[model samples]
Target: MLYLVLAVAIAGEIAATVSLKLSEGFTKLWPSVVVVAGYAIAFTMLSKALKMGMPIGVAYAIWSAVGVAAVAIIGWRFLGENLNPTMIVGLVLVVAGVVTLELGRMH
Candidate 1:
């Protein structure tokens, strides 16, 4: 299903992004390889979802926004990055916008 493919793409993208951060500017070998492979899988799944009747704009918006939010949380929790209230608010707004776009497409 398109939804399943999209979910996988999102998960792959999040994993890829996290691995990229752990790659330490790509100086590390294993994490760097993971980053590359994860991105490849993510994009492949995204392409499949597109072929399955999902709108390109909608899918891309959701994918990118969700990826950003997930990465921010990962950074905050695992990377010791600071996330103040403003940052959380901004992420919430991004998620809300994505939800609105998705809902609009159903009409």
Candidate 2:
């Protein structure tokens, strides 16, 4: 359940980040609204996950890793952003780190 909440939180954070880019320095009204609302929802859900007994370090590590990876994909696909080989390698490293963290927690 906590992981589920964290997943939602990650989604919210990703959406908020993407919307932030779309907002164009807050020049657009709708994207700006989305940015604010998305962040609010993301934080609220993240708090709920923490309250549900998830270890802070583990939860944060997973959230940030997944959010960053998803954002990178989104940016590459839709935002005209460059996703070079180095960036891909970096994202792979992030996923590997998350896996390592989760495995460590199992012990």
lDDT (Cα atoms) of all candidates against the true structure: 0.95, 0.94
Where model 1 places Cα greater than 4 Å from the true spot, the runs are none
Per-residue lDDT tens digits for candidate 2, residues 12-48, read 9999999999999999999999999999999999999
Indicate the residue-level lDDT of 39 in model 1: 97
Would you list the clashing residue pairs of candidate 1?
A: none
Clashes of each: 0, 0
Q: How many collisions between residues are there in candidate 2?
A: 0
Worst 10-residue lDDT window, candidate 1: 1-10
* Clashes by residue pair, model 2: none
Give one digit per residue, the lDDT tens place, for model 1 in 1-107: 78889999999999999999899999999999989989998999999999998999899999999999999999999999999999999999999999999999998
Model 1, position 63, has a per-residue lDDT of: 96
Error of 1 at 12 (Å): 1.0
Cα RMSD of all models vs. native, in order, equals 0.7, 0.7
Off by over 4 Å in 2: none
